[model samples]
Target: MMNILLLYISPGKTTEKISKALSDRFEADGHRVTRLNIGKPGSRTFKEVGSSIFYDMDLIGIGNPVFHLRVMHPLTEFLDQALPYAKPRFGAFLYLTYGGISSGRALLDLSNQLKKNNIPILGGFKVWAPHFYNRVEYPDIEARKTIDEFYSRIKESGYQPLEDEKTKRLFSYQTRKVNIAYHLANVIGNLRELPIQFDQDKCRGCNRCVNECPVGALTMQKIPVRDTSKCVYCYHCAAVCPHGAVICPTEKVADMVRTNKKLIGVENPQNAVYL
Candidate 1:
């Protein structure tokens, strides 16, 4: 049986859900699977995760919630640290849960990184998730099939490196058309920012946001205070908070999403597996 590792940063749990599904499928096929949620606050450092677990892993799957079409820290740092040890037959796949504005350059960016280390790019999967703070169905029937298809590629005795165009195409049909969005997202990524606010009245002195931040950007002194300098816009704080205390700029983001959705003619959500 092949040893598989799924290391992911899931700020909103959708990516976490997808990773677990993939893990379950890998185990069902009799492959040994090790899954890690490195997105959680207090989770093991990237260097620590890379030094021990990656050595024995035959295949690695990296999952992330695409923010502004990019991968964020913890995942970025973990992969960077793991690169020096990459070896032949150490295959890799990427599974992205995106809010659907655009998967952006995330797949292309990471695929290039792994290719530089000579890791075989087995496949890539993209799933449309509910937009932020709005209810949307995910991992639907089509999405489930995409998951299975990606696994079939892993079972192919030999892995192949993807062509430049095909690798970037994993950004999704919608993401490719919106080239401007990628540039806009790149600008936001540089800021290390999030458009969210906390209400002191509704906070209830809870430290959930502080404790759950992937980068420790939030601190609580009876209530939460965010340091935008450290925030990567993973949106975990609001997702974990029980009270309607964390006020994200949902309308602002949704408006932009709507404009982008219309541009791509997205009527219903879709999922795909890119080989």
Candidate 2:
């Protein structure tokens, strides 16, 4: 049995559901899995990537969500610090979950990034998941089919990188259409950070937001004080607040959800499996 490293960046937990589904399949096939959320504070992505432990891993599967039409990981930065220690045979795959009906360039963007770091991407799996954190519609009927097919193809190939032509066709995730909104958001985000307003009076000092922040952007001082620079604007703080103390733009969130829901299952190739 091989030792598999399944890493993900999930603020809403839907991507985690997708990773869990794959982990289940891998474990049932007698492989040992070490699943980690690299976005979380203590679980640094470079720690594993830079260590000898990563060199020993039989398979590395990285999962991420598409935000603003791009992959949510700062992997190129992390890999810069970690690639010096890495050896050959970088057996790996990609998993992407997008709130929008279309993933745009999310998968291909990441695939190209990893290739630049000299990591051989064996496969990629893409799924259309719910945009909201409260929803649990991941690994749905379509996602399940792709997950099963992806795992089966990998196992049959003996976990090696599949042929170049096949890999290019499936895992590349190519498309001519560009998302102008995504491009605008990317530029806007660089200039300004999203505001997370807190209502101290309503706060009961439960500390849920502080503890649950994926990037540890919040600290408890009187109430939860935020480091705007560190926050990724997941709005998870507002979702987890028990007392409604964490205030965010509810209407914007609703509009994004409504827009995404209306476009569900409309993308020509919403869910994809690469072998």
Candidate number of the best TM-score: 2
Candidate 1 matches the true fold with a TM-score of 0.83
- Report residue 6 deviation for candidate 1 (angstroms): 0.6
Write down the worst ten-residue block by lDDT for model 2.
185-194
Q: Please estimate how well model 2 matches the true structure, expressed as its whole-model Cα lDDT.
A: 0.72
The digit string of per-residue lDDT tens for model 2 on 16-105 reads: 889999999999979889887766666655764447657678778878887766766454456556555554454678888876546767
The digit string of per-residue lDDT tens for model 1 on 127-219 reads 877754676665667667878887787567355656666766654456545577666545544443436888878988768778778777888
Residue 28 CA displacement from its true place in model 1, Å:
0.7
Error of 2 at 101 (Å): 4.1
What TM-score do all the candidates reach, one by one?
Answer: 0.83, 0.84
Q: Each model's C-alpha lDDT? A: 0.72, 0.72
Pairs clashing within candidate 2: none
